[model samples]
Target: SKITDLEQREKAQYDEITSLKAQRDSMFLDNQASQEKDRDFLKQKISDLETRCKAAESEKSSLKFEIEKEKAKLNYERDHLESIKSEMQETINKLMKKNEQLIA
Candidate 1:
């Protein structure tokens, strides 16, 4: 009778161990699924950031081109003004020489 009782207790302990193993397996699967979700979220965030960076680079290039064009226009205007000033100075000198002759 005592041997039979020990055998029953051993069988009960084996069943409990099996149940615990199944519970641990389920928890492991749940953690794996959660990690996959987090990885996907981070990937999408990185892709969005890359797109924004490209758009900003394009806008910066366009602004730089516009600034260069404005600088060229300013240079042309400055050269033209300098030429006009030179011609006016030469005309004044001619007029002064003529006035001196008339007075003499």
Candidate 2:
């Protein structure tokens, strides 16, 4: 009778250990799956950010080109105005000289 009791106690302990091992393995698998999902989400987010960065770079390049074109246009306009101002000064001088001669 004592031998039977000892066998039963041993079997109960063995069953409990097996159940604990299975629980531990299940928890480990769940953690691994969670980490994999997080990694995939981060990868997708990084890809989207890279795409947006490329688009912003393209837009900045286009804006720089437009600014350079505007600078060239402004320079050309300033030079043209300078030429007109010089011609007007020459005409004014001529008119003043003719007026002086008439007064004399």
**Worst 10 contiguous positions by lDDT, candidate 2:** 2-11
Candidate 1, clashing residue pairs? none
**TM-score per model over all chains:** 0.76, 0.88
Name model 2 segments beyond 4 Å from true: none
For candidate 2, the lDDT comes to 0.99
lDDT of 1: 0.94
Q: Can you give the lDDT of residue 93 in candidate 1?
A: 93
Which pairs of residues collide in model 2? none
**Worst ten-residue run, lDDT, model 1?**
10-19
Clashes of each: 0, 0
